[model samples]
Target: MIDSDLPLLNLRDICKSYGSTPVLNGVSLALNGGQTLALTGESGSGKSTLLHLAAGLDQPSDGSVHLDGEDIGRLDDAGRAQIRRDRIGLIFQQFNLVPSLNVAANVALQAQMANRFDAAFTAEISDRLGLSDLGARYPEQLSGGQQQRVAIARALAPRPELILADEPTGNLDEETGDIVLTLLLELVAETGAALMMVTHSPRLAQRLSREVHLSRGQLAVQ
Candidate 1:
């Protein structure tokens, strides 16, 4: 069972550096269930790095990251990978879908890998994301919006505890991006999952419950 009082994600004095160049310095934050946090920053502000640390994709050079009360930084590579696979959902601006796979297959891929595929849940997510009719189509067959929907569906299919989205709607027009953002937030709300999305758009960030700004490797609440 998930602890409601405890933060779903916790970062404490997190720091990262590439060689001698510091990327993130003493960053800390907390996220609770069903909370949506928009991480806003200019280019090279370490927003992506913070997300990667939260996802356990990269280890912090100093400090700790706790997900569900477990210190992810202490886990081994395989362990971290398993945690990422099982507990975190990641959405990228590029809409990283397998070109050959149809929508249904791509959406079900992670659940299949985790051996937690649920046909009913998958169907529900597909329908909710407006991908029900396009399940048989390949990634190339879809438009930018459609492809993004597929990515969102895939992320939610696994029922992860946390969702990390990096510029999820960056490539789309304002109207399309708004639609996608609405859908994504609705899904996150329905699932009661924690979400931290990196975006440069202040308008988009305003939709979230809270906003955090990253500037020169430091985090500031906004």
Candidate 2:
């Protein structure tokens, strides 16, 4: 049964491979509620792959992934998707927003799907993200930083228990990245959500509660 006492996400001896080309190996980690962990590594170091496994977007070839005490690896596609939609928030470098939806709709999309939408909360997040004036704008109408802010608002809208972010600030200027990171940290803290973010920026990683380095498909505490 899912329980609050359990770690939000736990990975044990995880491994992944594609046609004998191994990606992750024996990567073990656990994240608890209200904690922020930074995952850092070079390109091809398997940071994104590890994030995917944690999010249940893919299964590890060996070992287990537990989210809220449920073994995600044992779940069928539909079950995993349900957990992802309802409990986990994801932010990626691509900032996947529906072009047809305006900023307001985009921000509220996941929350609505999760059946946790709140008009006041959505408006509050948009205003906090500096998106209040841009609610009617589409993705293309916004700058990179603005678009990423929208993505952040969308992810946090549901007040999820866990947040998995992959280089969410990778494309922004240093100042904008700092702003986004600050807001993300602050919001997650306010919501008491566990966070595991993949970032290449050492400076940014320093802000997290913990940091781990991924290399050659393995993890080392930093």
Candidate 3:
């Protein structure tokens, strides 16, 4: 049974396909606030696809996705965009920051778009992510780890209810990746936000509260 005490993130019989190719087939899972769920799978196993669906970045062919009791799958495009803008935070391995913008602007960009920019909170997040001294630096000036940190800071600055991370440490070396993962989890815990991270590393998955394996688009408890 799903726990009611925790904030809810529910996916029911989710299905996705690209033409005749099925990526996620009847997958289902639930994540709660202050909880970290690791999604692991081999290449092409649909881990990233599931994360995208959960974040409302893409729609499932059939199924329902609910966040905090609201069914996101049923929302219109504009509605989905609003949810993404206001309540959902996404981090990617690519560190999709605007190169022209310095760290502070990049971190505050999303919050500003959502009209939720709080200078004090942004500053706090920057410090927590160890990005205070780099605020004036551009993405190009930072190293891989630092770039990822900026991405993390950007995602957390809005204080979203949920954070969806797709291979957040995929680009880093083992040591750097571990450090970045540590900070990600620490920040998530401090904010009391739910995190769903898609990764292929068993070590990383083990660090989470729960590990889920995705094979041929189906979720299996690990």
Best by lDDT: 2
48-79 per-residue lDDT for model 1 (tens digits): 99999999989999999999899988899999
- Cα displacement (Å) at residue 139, model 2: 1.7
Off by over 4 Å in 2: none
What TM-score against the true fold does each predicted structure earn?
A: 0.91, 0.94, 0.88
Ten-residue segment with the worst summed lDDT in candidate 3? 1-10
For model 2, name the residue pairs that clash: none
Tens digits of per-residue lDDT for model 2 on 136-162?
999999988889889988998998889
Better of 2 and 3 by TM-score: 2
Q: Model 3, stretches more than 4 Å misplaced?
A: 1-7
Where does candidate 1 stray beyond 4 Å? none
The predicted structure with the larger TM-score, 1 or 2, is: 2
Error of 3 at 67 (Å): 1.2
Output the worst ten-in-a-row residue range by lDDT, candidate 1: 179-188
**lDDT of the structure predicted as candidate 3:** 0.85
lDDT of each residue in 120-200, candidate 3, tens digit only:
988987876678999899999999888987887788778787889998887678886787678778767887778999988
For residue 148, model 3's alpha carbon misses the true position, in angstroms, by 2.1
